[model samples]
Target chain A: MKEIYLDNNATTKVDEAVFEEMRPYFCELYGNPSSMHFFGGQVQGKVTEARGRVATLLGASPEEIVFTACGTESDNAAIRSALEVFPERRHVITSRVEHPAVLTQCRNLTQRGYRVTEIGVDGTGRLDMEELQAAVDDDTAIVSLMWANNETGVIFPVEEAAALAKSKGALFHSDAVQAVGKLPINMADSRIDMLSLSGHKLHAPKGIGVLYLRKGTPFRPFLVGGHQERSRRAGTENAAAIIALGKACELAGQHMDAENTTVKALRDRLQDALMRIIPHARINGGGAERLPNTTSIAFEFVEGEAILMLLSELGICASSGSACTSGSLEPSHVLRAMGVPFTCAHGSIRFSLSRYTTEAEIETVIREMPPIITRLRQMSPFGREFLKEQS
Target chain B: MWDYTPIVKDHFLNPRNVGDIPDADAVGEVGSLACGDALKLYLKLDESKDKIVDAKFQTFGCASAIASSSALTEMVKGKNLDEALAISNQDIADFLGGLPEEKMHCSVMGQEALEVAIAKYRGHEAPVHSHDHDHGPAYPDQEGTVVCKCFGITDVFLKKVIETNRLTTPEQVTHFTKAGGGCGGCIPKIKELIDEVMGARPEEPRKRPEKLSNMKKMQLIQEVLERDVRPLLWADGGDLELIDIDGSKVQVAFRKACAGCASSGNTARMVEIKLRDLVAEDIVVEEVPA
Candidate 1:
């Protein structure tokens, strides 16, 4: 079976070019970038070039990018550094829809006597700016929010949010793990003090991430030991993955136009066809500005895991916000925080496309999805009643 | 990702019976859209109304849930009401080779629907339809106080699952019945219920061996503490570390929530009782301040 991989937000395939760029680092060019020898000096030059590429993608200086293990580490470093930098400030603010990388860390801060406020989102998964504005006060050390929601694909007004945090003299951070490659981001033009991005979310291999700290932001190290990463992060450089990520970011910059146009058209066509063919369904973040490559559809009267399993049979990969899929007894916090009703919350499926997603793949999903919904609905008691009423 | 057995996949992909019997002799429904899974089981009995001649199901849930429902309908087709009533959740899981531990609640839902169907047919109680969505008990006809408000599960329902499955921890209860899986506010209550159910079981007295090396006795005590006692404490966010053992007396120190608790004495006594029953009749548990 030819796999139609659409779960890109979860992770993306490593581009072949990016893989080839990193291949030599493992064998022939395997030298510690920090070693004193000339062999190492040559590796260091490539690493510097990679850093420049990544910096160009984000409109940041090479000095601002500190590579870490993954997005979670970058997020932890960003928020914990802000808290350490402003120890007297005892409050943190975030949104209910933030990825767990930020949300869980902010929540854990509460146990250490820090007040954490999670601003809610509206029905369309749009961040409640008013709630955020009220939550940001003099005592707030930092306000960490996501640039885009992973499940709903809803884009937040993060630059405006950073401005709100700045007015209160609070440091601002954004977990741009989902938005960095999908959307255009220029740190030089923004008030976001710290931003985190994962390599794997942008078609690089895993195990590499970047924390962009604005040049003049007061900061502290989350991991402190070696002089690696200018002592901001203390670990041996993940040179190969870093080089791969740099190449991926450069490619992402080149593909940004097609990502916004071609990929967006594919996402829109898939969303529109599913909505038209399948009754009793709604797009989760339809009213909000969303990432061009993502769509979350909620099919009523059926569970998401069941839909996903049937889709899996056809080698069509996707993801869900359903409780059962995640091994939890409650629907996703993202949907719940958005005030999505229980009826649809338990049945939301997320389809995230990438540059690799072909037009035929989208068409195949459109053809196979409705019958799967129809089959599951026919087997559902609530769906049966609804079908009866419709007939 | 679930490690679903091949049989489970077979059943999920090609479910045995997947519709309704409009003239069903009894209709049993459990769970709701809010709960993330639901099953509407319909049974058609023979002319004598003793044996189930036909069984069909309509389910709204994940793969394991649909497979369990389909397995239940197939298993109950030729069985009489009493025979069907004898089927446990484990029996349903075993029919499908086995379901993942986290997916056990799907099997429990199947068993509950079967019991509800038979109970309704026998006029034991009124049928509670899930479509009402009142957030009331999933099995309102079965009597008990509502313990897990999130899933509308009652103490009666919980105790039955715990006792039948021999479940010791709150996590198992959640996996089996979805109680204490949401918000987790009722977790302490669930721990208490587990204690009550496990305590109600009859303990058989074991004849103590006449002679044992001191090392062996100490090892036995530690094994019992690790296997039997710590889980119960861990469920309540508390734990005990064995400090030392001198002959029959075991010195222990409470940790976490158990430390400095006013009820530490009662907890110590309970530990002593457990050690006495499981190891030796004269074992003593002494709590030392942490």
Candidate 2:
């Protein structure tokens, strides 16, 4: 069975162009960027060019980008620095549906005498702006919100939310990991003070991430070692990944239209067909404006892992919002925050498409998915009860 | 994706006896959707009612859970009712090659269902066990302390698994029985259980001298940290350093992997308890974040 990879939101395959660009950096141009020699100087110029390309993608100056390990590190660096710089402040604000990188860290901060306010989301996964407005106050040190949710691909009002945070004299940060390549962002308009992005989510390799610290955002070093990243971040940069990220970003500029059109159509087609064929199937966050490539479906009375396993057998790879898939007892925080019922939450599957997802693959999934649900339902005890109720 | 054995995959993909039997002599149900897994089992007895001629199940759960339920029905087919009732969770795991430790609860669910099924066959109303604390070995419903609030695991179950399995680490205890897999307020208690069960050394119970100087107390605390705590932690790619001594309250920084380790709460308790046993009974240890 040929693999149909629709779990792109988890991690993308590195583009051939991006890989080729990074190839030279590994063996040929292995000079230390911090070194003074002509050999190192040449390599440093390439890195600087890479930085400019990333900056161009976000519509920001090169000086604003600070490279870090990954999206989590970027988020940590940004949030930790903000709290440290404003020692008098003791409160933080974020949405309940944020990725664990933001949510767990903020929750952990509560133990250190920091009060965190997690703004609620509606059934459609849209942030409640009134609640967010009420949550932000003078004592708030930083407000961290995700530009887009990875699970539902629901876009939050980052620009509006960031502005609200800044009104109360709080530093605003957005983890734009899922949004960077998918959405056209202009940091020059500048409501966002810090934005964290990862390489892997946008067809670049992992091990490299960027924290766009809009210049003069009271920075404190997270990984303090050598004077790398202008002493804002320390330790040596992942040179190959940084170079690959630049190429990926430059390509992302060209591919945004296809992502919003062709990839989005594939997602919509798959979602519409599955919902039509399978009874009691529903879409999560269907009411909101979602990313072009993501669709989350809940197959009622069926287990997500069982559905995923059946899908895996046919080489249709995707992720689950199910707790069993994560080895935890609770389903996804995003679904729970949106008040998705227990019947649906444990059985949710996320199909996040990419530019590479073909129309034929979507058709195959549409054809294959209905029978799998029917088969699982036939074996399920609750499915029988649910069917009787429906009848 | 949980690295389930090939047999588990097979049982899951082609689960046996999937539907309920119409003329089942006994029906047993366990778990709930809120708990993330549930099983409904039906046992049809032969003419004598001594042996199960056929068995079937209906499950609402993950792959491992469905597989475990399916596996149980297959294992009990054409078996004596007493023999079927005797099969344990470990037997189910062994029948399916093996299950992941994290998914061990699924097998436990199967055991609970089978036990209830047999009880029903014998006309005894089985005790109800839900996903919450009511189902644990030692909870409010039972005799011992409910150690892990997250998974509703009890100290009695913790101690039993430790002695039965000859377990050493707190991580192992969570694996065999989900005792400390929760908010971890009970981790210190788990560490103490492991210490009491595994470290069965005759304690001298160091008697305190009257009117010891502050300097002497600090030295004793430092001596214990260097001698006892740091070495045990260093063996596990973890280390700690004593920061300050505020009378009986000792502040320390957990360094290396132990600094932000999930088990550090238990590890910290292990240190405090060990210090009290070695240094002073009233000595309290707190981690000052590094």
Candidate 3:
């Protein structure tokens, strides 16, 4: 069966162009960028060019970009550096809906005698800016928020939130892992002191990420070792993956309009069709501004793992916020923080699109999704009651 | 993705008896929308009102849940009420070629529904589905206080699962019954219940032998400490190492959270009790500096 890959928020297929760009670095151009020989000097030039490409896409200077292993590493480095740089500060601020990369770090800090406040989200998955405003005080060392939620695709007003943090002398960081390529971000005119982005989310290979540090920002190194990444991040560079990410970023810049237009249309058509054809279903973050490529739909009276299993049988890949799929026995933290009802929270399925998502795939999903919901509902006791009431 | 068995996938894809018998003689329902999974099982008894002539199920849950329900209906079709009640959650899992450990609760849900249906059929008051308020016991028919508020599970229900599954840890209890899977405020209580249930087991194989040499007694003491005592401490994020064994006195040092805990004295007393019960009646446990 032909696979209809839709789970882009989880990860994306490496773009062919990005793959080609990194192909030569594995064995042929296998020189460390820091080596003193001529062979290493040539590889260093390519590395510099790649850095410039990545910088261009983010509207950041090449000097501000420090390559890390992946988005988690970038997130860790950004948050840890801020807390270390401001030792007198004893508080951290984040949101309940942040990815585990940021949320876990902030939570672990509490064990070390640091106060951590997690701002809640409203019903539409929108950040409670008022709660953030109230939480940010002079003792707060950093405020870490995600630019866009991975599950609901709800966008956060990080620029305004950063201003709030700045007013309190707290460094603001954004984990833009899900937002960087899908949404245009210009760090040059932003108040965000640190920004983290991953490679695989935007069609680059995995194992490469960037931490954008604003120039003149007071900082401390998270990893102290050899002078790779200007000693900001230690360990030998993942040379090939870095090259891949740079090419992917340049391509993302060129395809930004298409992502917003063509891809957005595909997502809307899928969402509208499913809502129309299926009964007792609702979009999770329908009231909020969301990324163009993502839609989370909650099918009532059914669980998400059952829906996903049926979809997997038909080779239609997607993800779920249901407790069963997550192995947590509770629904997604993102949906839970949004105050979604348990009836819907246990049944939410997320479908994330990418530039490679075709119109036919969306049509296939629209056609196949209603029956899957219908079949599961037919087998559900609650669904039977709802059907009886309808009759 | 869950490593669902082939039998599970087959059952989920084409579930057996996937609807209600409107004239069902005995209907049993367990779980709620809030719990993320639920099953409504129906049984049509024969004219004798003893044997289950037909069984069907309607489920709102994951693949394993649906599969477990389907497997239960298939397993109980021609069995009498007593025989059907004899079916354990493990039997239901075994019928489906075994479910994942985390998905064990699905099989337990199937078994609970069966018990509720049979109890209701016998004209006994089974408050399995009476979840009208949050503060009341989740299953009023069952005894004991509520433990997991998120799932509205009671201590009696948790103990039953823990005992039947031979579960030793709080995490295993969560997998089987979702007792401490929520806010986990009741985790300490769950651990106490586990100890209570495990301690009450009949004819435990870990009992101390009646006659033993000093060498055998020392080995048995170490075995009991490693096998029984340390695991219980580890559950509470504490640990202990046997530092020295001098005659009847067993010297130990606490590590992690147990080292300087205000309750270390109490913990040491508990260890002494366990050692006496399992190793030797006169054995003593002493706390020593690390």
Candidate 2: Cα lDDT at A391: 78
lDDT at position A207, candidate 3: 86
User: In candidate 2, how many Å is residue B58 off?
Assistant: 1.2
In model 2, what lDDT does residue B11 have? 90
Off by over 4 Å in 3: B127-141, B200-290
Would you list the C-alpha lDDT of every candidate in the order shown?
0.90, 0.85, 0.90
- Candidate that beats the other on DockQ, 2 or 3, i.e. the better one: 3
Q: Candidate 1 chain B: worst 10 consecutive residues by lDDT?
A: B127-136
* Pairwise DockQ winner, candidates 1 and 3: 3
RMSD of each: 10.9, 13.6, 10.9
Candidate topping DockQ: 3
> What DockQ class does candidate 3 belong to?
medium
Candidate 2 per-residue C-alpha lDDT over A1-391 given as tens digits, one digit per residue, 9 for 90 to 100 = 6899989999999999999999998888998888999988887888899999999999999999898889999999889999999999999999999999999999999999899999999999999999999989999999999999999999999999998998998999999999999999999987899999999999999888999989778888888888998999888777888889999999999999998988888888899888888899889999999999999999988889889999999999999998889876668889989999877998899999999899899999999998888788777778888777777
Q: TM-score of A-chain in each prediction?
A: 0.99, 0.98, 0.99
Candidate 3 iRMSD in angstroms: 0.6
Off by over 4 Å in 1: B126-136, B200-290
Compare candidates 1 and 3 on lDDT and give the better one: 1
